[model samples]
Structures are given as C-alpha cells and as structure tokens.
Target: MSTEEKNPIIKIYMLGRFALEYDGEIILEDEGKIHKVWSLLGYLLANHSRKLGSQELPELLCADERSGDPAKVVKNLAYRLRCLLSDSGLPKETYIVQSGGSYSWNERLNYTIDTDEFLASYKRARQGGIDEQTAIDCYLQAISIYQGKFLPHAVYDQWAAHSTTYYHRLFTDSIISLYRLLEKKETYELMLPVCEKAIGIDAYDEDIYRIYIHCLTKMGRHKEALLSYETITNRLYDEMGVNPSGELRSLYREIMKTLKSVETDLIIIKEDLNEGGQAECCYFCEYQIFKDIYRFIARRVNRTGESIFIMLCTLTDKEDEIPSKKYLAEAMESLKVSIGKTLRKGDLFSRYSHSQFVVMLPDISYENGYMVGKRIQAAYKKNKVSKVVTMHYKLQPLDPKHF
Candidate 1:
C-alpha cells in the first residue's frame, strides 16, 4: 500500500510531548534546537478553525529577544516554516496559508490532529443517541489520547496552556459521565479498569472515587475499596488540607460493616485487632513532630535531670561518598528496619532525611547513649546491600539539670 493510503493524511501529536508525522514517518528536524517552525505549525493546526493575528505568533515565540521588529521575524519564520513542512514530502502550501493580515492552516490536507479529534469524539459521544456503551467507548478513546498536558514541552506558549486547561476539564467530565453510565449498567468487570485509569488521571475527583467504591463493593473487594478511599483522603489531608465528603464516609461505614460480617476467620480478625505498632522502638511521625518533641524534652530536662541523648546516623559509601539514589533509598529502608530491631522498647527514633536517622535515648547515661549509637550502627551495617554502604554516627549527650 502507498504511504498516504496506508496512514493518516497528516498526524499531529501534542499530548505529553509534541511531534508530527506526515503519512507514517516522523518528521525530522534540528538535532537539538527547539525550532519555532513546528510549534507554530502545531498551533495553527490546533486552532485550525480560527484565524491567528500576525502579532500573536511573534508575542508567543519571539517576545524575549526584543532586538528588532517581531512582526518581521514572524514573517520570515512563516516562510521558513512553509519550506520546512514542504520538505516533509508535502506540498509547499498544503498545510499552511496566509490571508488578510492573519495566518492559519490550509485545512485542505486529509489530516488528523490529536486534540481536535479528541474533542470531536467527545462532543459527538455526549450528543449521540442514548446508547451508554457507545458513549463509554468514545470516552475511552479520548482519555487514551490525552497522555499528558497539551504541548507539555512548549510551556511558554499561552495558547497551549489555555488549550491544556480546556482539554483537562473535558477529559475529567468524560470520565465522570462514562463511569456513571457503566455503574448504571453494573459492568463491574470493565468498570474497575475505567475507574483505575480515571483515578490515575485525576486522583482528587470525589465523583470518580464514588463510582470506584461502588464497583469495588459490587465485586466484594471491600478491603481494596476501603484502602483506596483512605489513600484519597490522606492525599487530601496532606495535599489539600481537606476531609472526605459525607457521602464517602457513609460508603466507608457500609464497607466496614461488610468487613465485620464477611471476615469469619477469627484468627484474621484477631490479627487485625492486635497487630498494630511495635514496642521495639517509639512512634515515628513527621520530621516536624520529631523536632517539636525534642524541644519539649529539652525544656523538661532542666528540671528532671533525665540524661537525654540524641543520635544522628547517616549512611555513607565505604569510600565516604554519598551513594546513588537507588542505593541510598534501599540502604535507608534497611537501616530503618535495623534501627527498629536494635532500639530498646522505650527509645524513640525518627527518620530525619533520606540518609539521616535521629534517635532519642532518654534516662540513659552518657556511656550507654554512646553504646546505643554503636548498636544502631552495627544493626544498620548488617543490612547493607554491599560493602559500599556503611554507617556514620554523631551522639549528643545532654544533662541540663547538672549543667
């Protein structure tokens, strides 16, 4: 089959990143430079229905240079852009045209633009007949096309930013509609994946979570449904400083009821009730909480005469340099486990950084505090993945009452 016959007339991709393909082959360009040629072409094609004023392109592209006339630069760039497109096995004027103090795509070429096609499919699906299944299929197609923000690499372009916001709203709306229709049909098998993808795209949407919870409940996956609800609420708490809605709380109460009745295994129920927190080490919380506790202890030590010691443990390579991020992360996790095993039941420890651990040994003498730090170092070293991973420590002993 011929190239033109076998492929899209011209394919323009602006999702995630930006690229163009005429027929089936990717159009090649400069080895490294970000050229204005293709970006302008994409803008024209994306806004194909509207005419862009001459000044708009210059302001979007060449606003920073401010050396000469931006309009002249736009004019020159337009000619170069036409030639560049023409070199891509297309006619000189097949895709771009200039008219009446404005520029736009020729609109004559048989072409498919990702954003346009997505929007068109979305509109038709919403306006189509009352067939829920067909609407869902169209929504899936649109969602799949939107891999990321519109023209993600071209952040400076105001038009691209505006288009991105518009498409994101459409994408979420489609998910909201599609999930409702699927839930109405009771297609839990297919609806689960749809809910997951929708969550992956927009984790904060309570509407998506509502349908997701319903699907999970239908499939008897109440545990996973509760976990997902907790995940979203934690995200909201940490990221948005908000709580889950009353509707979500009601759904969760029902899940709890189901779990209580469904789990007939007394052993499992017993484990869930009794298997929380360890006495080997004290509570771990946010770094700020750790610091606050330390300050409170510092204040009491003056009156209590309690020998308080703080230890800082850091991971280092055998060569005394910081390890790679992967190694660092693994070493830290291992160190955390080892610290938990080595600390006494009442001792407190918190991870202070990716490579640092802070521990409080209260009521211990200076020598015992030093020994505790050594014990942590020994435990951390035992779990090292390689000889390159090692531990270094600093211990501070404070007895404010005697000072």
Candidate 2:
C-alpha cells in the first residue's frame, strides 16, 4: 500500500466487457497481447468477494492446459500481474493478495465493478413498495451499466452460467418492477421503449409480451400489438417451431374481440374489386400461424384417416439473369392471388419466404394434390406477372414429425 494514492480507485468493468481504468488512463488494452492477463483478471473478478484456494485457482485457470505444473504456471502469471499493476502505478499488494494458501482481489483496495454496481442498483430499486420515479431511476442505472452479458467472451464457459443467469434475471426483474409502477400511472409511451428493450434482451419472456401488448392497446395501437404477437410467434417458431402459448393466444383473441364490431355504414363500394365475392379459396395467414395450422392438421390426419399435403411454390428465373427485388415482390403477390383462386375454400396458405408461397391442402389424395398443384401452376401461368419469371413447386404428404 505504499503508492497508488494519487489515483486511489481502480475502475474495473465486468458487465459487458473486461476493462480496467486508473486515473482515467487505460491499461495495455489499446496496444497488444494481454489475453492471459485478461483471463487472470476475469477469474479474480468472478470470485472477487472471497479468496480461492491457491491450488484451486491454478487448476481452474489452467483447466485446458496439460503437461505443466499448474501451480508454477499460475505463480508466474500472478507475479506478472503484480508487475503489471506496479507498472501501472497501483500498489500491487493492494490489488492482489496472496496468503493462507489462497488468492483474491484485495478487499481493502478501493475499486468499483460494474457487475457489483448493477446488482446493488437493482436491489435498491426494488427494495421499496413500487415508487415509479425511483424505480425508473434505479432500473435505468442498472441497465446503463449492463452493456452486455456478464462476460461476452466467456459465454460458453461453465463458470459463467450462474452469473449470466443471475444478471439476466435481475434485468428482467427491473423491467417488471418498472412496468408494475408505470402501469399504475398509464405511462405507456414511456414504457414502450422499456418493453422493446427487455424484449430485445429476452424475447422468450411471454409476460413482457403481454405488457407490451397492453401498452400498445392502451396507446390505441392495436395493429402493432398484433404485429408484436406475431413477432413473438415467429421468433419462437424460427428458433424452435413451437406454437404460441395459451396466454398469447388469449391475448390475441381479446384484441380481435375488441376490433370485432362490424361497420354498419351504407355498404356500397365504388371500386367493387370483390365482385366475385372475396375471390374464394384457401385461408391465408402469417408464416408462423400457417406452421401451427400445418401441425394441427398433421395431428388429426392419423386419427381422422384424411390425407393432407403441403406444397411450396417458388419463383425462379427462366434465364440466367436475376430478377430485381421489385419484380420478385410483385411476382409473389400475383402468385398468391392466383393460388388463392385455384385452391379450395377449406385449404390454407401463406407466404413462406420472400418469393415462396406455401399451401396446405387437407382431405386430398396424392392425385388430387397434384391436380391442385397443376391448377395453381396453370392459374399463375395464365396471369404471368413477370414475362421471364415462372412458378416452380414441390408437393409432399403430411409428415407430422417434420412439422
């Protein structure tokens, strides 16, 4: 403790990145090789509150390296770290303490860690009985410090899981607490970004979706709420093709119910595009909903003894030249209309990708499925949106497990 008094505090950041600052001066981070130094600092920071046994520290640090004495290697690393600290003008003894057969970051040193501050701020914010302003301030403080996960570099390391999970939960809790307080005052505009942030952090949390939907509803943005629900369903499906939960479905139903009152105006349209009564045919839905419907139909085929098949129609260029994006999008929309006219009323379909339309035809045998596919192809060919682009299709029987 002889020196380091001029700049007494060590500012170490551990929330998102591993950083060390003293007297507003950064260590050898901007220049060169300090990976081993970084690893040593991370381990000590991870187990900062208490000392790790000398043997255990070395073994943990050198878990992957074999053929050498871990203790000797760790001793050399420790000495190197001490020298680094000394060269940086910090009292080396105050930074790393070695005694009683253990090693730890010296508790007596004046240092601030982002992870520790995040926890403390969240704790202070949630200690009271939901004061909105104070809760907002505290949660913001915690969130401001959380640049990213506990240690982005060591994300897969087994040692990082516990703290990562803890910080993740704390972040979610902060959002919940702030929401609970904001809900009382009906401050949805303020809560909107918060919900979006939390969802960006953990999209798997359905409760946050509920709050987000509620916010949208309160703000009279019902369509965006539905879009958010679809966003969740789509993400869940993409990551793991799962259905929307009961809560989410119920929320969607409630929103639809709110929008249900049919307009009773003197209904006479000047454009009159629906002269053929809504152009008849398959039910169209979003890709995620279409996937769920496919699975639902698959589950019943075995018991009901009905044949169901799915088809994908994609747009391909007739020649070597690639079509522009505008033409591709125009072609997809035109193909959707053609398919809708060709398929039966009971069938289901969706736009599966940028230029692909997927259709599910139920209670149809292989022959009939082929007939339906041909009908769609013929219809699309008849009204060719692009002169050089054409429709290509693949059909297969219902495979429940595949869905």
Candidate 3:
C-alpha cells in the first residue's frame, strides 16, 4: 500500500481552536507568529470546491495590511503552509494548486474536517422523515462535534464571523431539537448532561435553560431547578441589563408549584415559612413576588381603609444621568442595606431595574412614605458611598381603584 493509503485520514478541527491531526500527532500554530499561512490554508480548505483568484486571496488574507507586493506575500505564505503540511508527515504532494491567476485546494487529499461532518449531521437531523432514534443520533453527533463557535481564532475576519454565526445558530437549534426529542421520550435523566453542556457553550440561551430546568424538575430536583433559574435571571440582569422573558417567568411559576410538598398541618407550614429566622429588616423579594404582594395589598386597602404608597428609588450621576456599572452596583448594594435598615419589616422592596428599586409601604401616609425615602438617602450617605452616585426618589399613593 502507498504511504497515504496506509496512514490514518488527516483530521482538521476548526471549532474552538484550529488544529490538524495525523497518525496520533497534533499540529497547532505558533503563538507569537502571524497566522497568514494558517489563514490562507483554512480559507482555501473551507472553499475547496472553487478556486480563489490570486489577487483576491491576498486581499482576503491581508485586508488590514498595506503589503508592498501582495502577490509575493501570498506566494511566501503558500510556500510556508506547504512546508508546514510536509513537516507534519503527510504524503508529500501539492495541497494548494495554482491555475493561471487563481489558487484552489487539492481535491485528491484524503482528509476530513469537523465542520463538514457537523453540517452534514445537522442537516440530516433537521430534514425530518427519519425515525426518532435516528434523528436523535444525528443531533447528538452534531452536538458532540460542535465544541464551540467556528473559527474562534479568526472571529474578526468577515468570512469567519459570518460562518461563526451560522454554525452557532445551527448548534443552538440542534440543542433545542434534541431537548424536544428527549422530552418526548421521557428521558429526563439522559438530557441533564446534554443541557448542562449546551449551557456551558451558550449561557445566554434562555430556551436551553428552560429545557434544563424542566428536566431537573421532571427528576424531582426542584431545588436545583430553582437554583438554575435564579442563576440565569441574575446573570441576565447583571450582564445584559434585561429581565427574563414571560415564558421563563411562567416556567418559574411551574417550578414553584411543584417545589412545595403537600402539608395539612399549619404548624409545619409556618415553620417551613419561618425557616430563614426572624426578619431583621424589611422584606426583600423578586420582582414577580413583589408584584403579587402589591396586588394583595391593593385589594386589602379597600377593606381596611389603610393608606399604601409605592416609592421608586433611582441611582444616577450628579448630572442625573445613569451611573456607570461599577458605581451603580456599589450604590445599589449600599442602597439595599439602607432601605432594609430604614423601612419597617412589614414594608417590601425589590430591584425594579438595572438602576432602580421599588418599595411598597403599607399602613403609611404619603408624608411618612416621603420621609422614609429621605431616611434611605440619609443612610446611604452615612455608609460613605461614592459621591458620584446620586439617589432620586418618587412616591405615589397605591389606589385600590387602579388595581
């Protein structure tokens, strides 16, 4: 047999990192050197079926540089890439073919790229008409092959950037599809690790989190599901400055419904509710819980004729502009402590936005509510928070008729 026939098929990985493997040996680019050789080679290989014009190749490879001789630069890089392949112990043959003024990858090379297999598997899985198990197998294969975004090292390159987005979308779609199949099969345990892996690759994908949480709940791991929900929600707020979608919020309600066990004894329920110990300050809850509390209070006001007020505390710069993230975070923390200390335990508060908090004060007059807001500002200053952050407050009476 010829050397090429006897050797293992060369494998090229282009997902998380660029690499070439042959006969148990792996090749990677040198860290300190410019990657023109690898860049030229990767582009050619990615478009192997068609030839790239010699003039176009230089511009594509060195678009940012003002090369004195673009043709010579392309020639030198191609030579270096050929040497790289030769030194890697493959059969000595031309990998880049030049015809007239255009270059193309050798069609006869025996090699496989991860992206090719990934795309094929993804297409097969989504084409439908296949059996459930077969479709699932295809999806799992594609998911396993997709370690990360395509050409991560060349993300800034226009071509690589477009391909990166395309592949990432495919990977996320496969994950969602896999979840549906697994869910239909009622294989919650099998999906836990898959969802975890998917989340690691793309943390901001709410659909993956929803599927993960659903699987966890199905396995009766209510605490884990709740923890995941809290984690994603906090990350979304802190990083993206947005709230969870209504679908995610609805899923949270489902988790809460399943989290509690059936209990007839009021004493046990009371103990469960008081497990966190005596309240040392005002009640702090999620925005959803705050909404529920506000609604209940609005209803109760009609019967008890008690006064209720809502206060909005906003953090801004001296010019009344929103503060920077660092300042806003520190000021928000300090403000939380201040509100907890100044307000009565019966009062409720929640973070209303990236730079604001909402407080509900029951059984208090409008004047008292305003005073409470001033007390919070005073406490915030006493804590020696940054002077750049300014606190602004607005109060409105809670009217039952508006409920």
Candidate 4:
C-alpha cells in the first residue's frame, strides 16, 4: 500500500487458521479461485506493520517461479486484492493503497492481531510483581491463546519465517517468566511439567535447565538434579565452548552436598526401619521435606557458590513419624558429632521438616569434595546400614571450557 496515503482507516485482518473476525464474521477469499491475489495480499497484510515496494510484492508472490513477468502479475493481483478488501467492509483508507511502484497497508487500520493481545497481557503480568496474582493470570491467558504455530501452512515464505521467530520468542519468554514467578513460591511440583514442555521445544535454553534443577531439588531428587547440572555443563562446554555460569557452578556444588546428606539420612532411616517401611516416603512427603531444605540453603547461599555443602537427614519411616523433642534432640546431637566437626563456622544446622536435619556449608571445593565425602562416610559408619549407603559422586569442573 501507498505510504503517502492520508486519512487511512483501520481494518482488522485475521488470516491465520480459519480467518474469522473478532466480531464473529468470517472472511474467506476463495483461495482456489484467487491464489495469486490471496498470496500477495497475505504477504502485504502479514507485513502490515511495515511498508513494501511494488517490485518486491511480485517477487514475494512468485518466489518459487523461475522466469515470468512477476512485476505485472503483482500489479494486477494487488488491484484485485484491494478491491476485495474494499468490498469486504474495509474502508477505502483501510486496505492496501498504491504508492510509487510499491503498495502499503493502510496504517490507520486499527486492526489487532491475537498475538498483540497476548503480548500485552504477558507484559502486564510480568510487571505486576510477585504479589500480583492477576499478572500470573493474565500471563497464562496470553499463553493459552497460542493455539498453534504462528500462521501455520503459510509455506516457506520469509513473512511466515518472521512470524515463526516472533512466536518462538514470545513462547520462550512467557515460559521463563512463568517459571520465575512460580519459583519464588517454590512451586516446583506444579511447574515441573511446564518447564519440561519448554525444554522440549528449546533444549539449549539455560532457563529451562535452571527450572528443572529447581524442581528436582525441591522434590528431593538430588542425584537426578545433579545430573541436570552435569547435562548443562556438558552442553555448554561441548557446544558453546564455555563454562557454566557462576550461579550454576555454585548451584551444582550445593546439590552435591545435598546429595551426600540425603544418602546419609536414607541410611540412618533404613537402619532404623524394621522392614520395607523405607518406601513409605512418598513423592509428596519427600518433595515437601526437600523444599524446606532447599529454602534453607537458598537463603544462606544467597548469591555465592559457597552454599553447596548443605546436607539434610530425614526419617524414612512414615508411620512412626511422631516423636518427643528430647528424642529428636538426642538424634540431632548424635548427628552433630557425626558431621559437625567436618563443618565450618558459618555452616547452618536446622530441623527443617518433620524428620529432616539440614546442614548448610557456605564454602566447598573439588579438592575438599573427597574430604567432605570421607567425613560424611564416618558419620554414616555409626549407622546400621552404613555399608549400603552408596557413595555417588559427580564433580563439576570450574573451568569455563569444561562447563
């Protein structure tokens, strides 16, 4: 359309998947009868936010063609599409108007795309902050509007590619935002599946890995969580030729300590268990217990890699959970003797969950990882099932190249 055209009117154009108006009107320009005309119009309307030259219009419409008078064909199709737009209630100033050799859609057409509405809602939600439930509601509403790939079946056109890129970004940002919001509340169980879906689309994205790590940690899947860190490390190293970010490196080390503590606690529980009562630790209970420990570590770790040496001990028996404070104190005292000497001055010790004792170590390293392992080993030696407590270790190198 002509950029110089004045007094243009706004006409909403919906072209994706069953073109229907916001007011419930359907606009179906027989694709079978006017393929060339529709293609040119779709191209122009898709680029409605920008201006295009008349010469460029034909080339866009006849992109796959070898040798034909694309210029003349574009001119004729533009004329027909313009007429169609007018007949279809588009004001004279609304549809495409002729410029020099080029054409431009009427900028005055106050048409709104579904995606625009989605973006508006998403932004509002993000800026609303943590206490704003409405923001999360709006963000989710926007996400739901993304029913399918943007402008599906538009073929290999450049305009379609642009739509694809835009939608991909929107989806990714929405996922990241949603994850961040939910993370503050430690809603890992709720957000895990959503994070996985986003990872399925863009596995290279670091945010997805971070979300996964958070979820795994809260769920007390320490070993599995460590594997995720390793995966990210390997991916960053092998592909980006870089090391994990400082935050991630620190998180990895923290998970290592948590893993060790969890193993020791499991051993204590198993030794105390009469039989198969160990499996009574359901995912829900385990998740709750782990979340408490994670929150404790997350607070102490704050912004340093120093918080990786945290550990938690939890009772595996579900039925015999209730006990006196004195009994608990004795257990805590025994745990202190077993692991306390190995801890530093600022290391945190707390009774986090119903049957869990969490220990936070602010600073730890690869060279000392083995030492911590040995110290934990000694603590477990007094336990009945010390030998069965498998000592699993996965060390992450600090070098950027190793990720």
lDDT of 3 by residue, 171-226 (tens): 88998888888889899887888888878878888998999999999999999999
lDDT of 1 by residue, 253-362 (tens): 77767865567888989887763654445555444457768888877987776788888888788778766665776777788787778777777788665567888888
Instruction: Give the C-alpha lDDT of model 4.
Output: 0.59
Candidate whose lDDT is highest = 3
Candidate whose TM-score is highest: 3
- Model 1 segments more than 4 A misplaced: 1-8, 28-35, 89-93, 199-210, 226-255, 260-268, 271-403
Worst 10 residues of 2 by lDDT: 266-275
Indicate whether candidate 1 or candidate 4 has the larger lDDT. Answer: 1
Candidates sorted by lDDT, descending order?
Answer: 3, 2, 1, 4
lDDT of each: 0.73, 0.75, 0.84, 0.59
Residue pairs whose backbone atoms clash in candidate 3: none
Q: What digit string (tens of lDDT, one per residue) describes model 2 on residues 1-403?
A: 1234654677777766666787786653412256566667678887888888977877666787883788888887888888877787554546778886688888667678888889889988978686668878898788777776777666665677888888988887777777777778888887788778777767777888988998898788888988998888766644443566778888887776674345545453433324456646578887666877777777777567677888988887777343455467567667888888888888889867556778988888889898888888887877656576788888998876643
| Candidate 3 vs candidate 4, lDDT winner | 3
Instruction: Give the Å shift of residue 347 in candidate 3.
Output: 2.1
Give candidate 4 misplaced runs (Cα > 4 Å). Answer: 1-42, 48-56, 62-68, 75-112, 126-131, 147-163, 223-250, 260-403
Q: Please report how far candidate 3 places residue 340 from its true position, in Å.
A: 3.4
Question: Candidate 3 deviates by what RMSD?
Answer: 3.0
TM-scores for all predictions: 0.62, 0.67, 0.89, 0.44
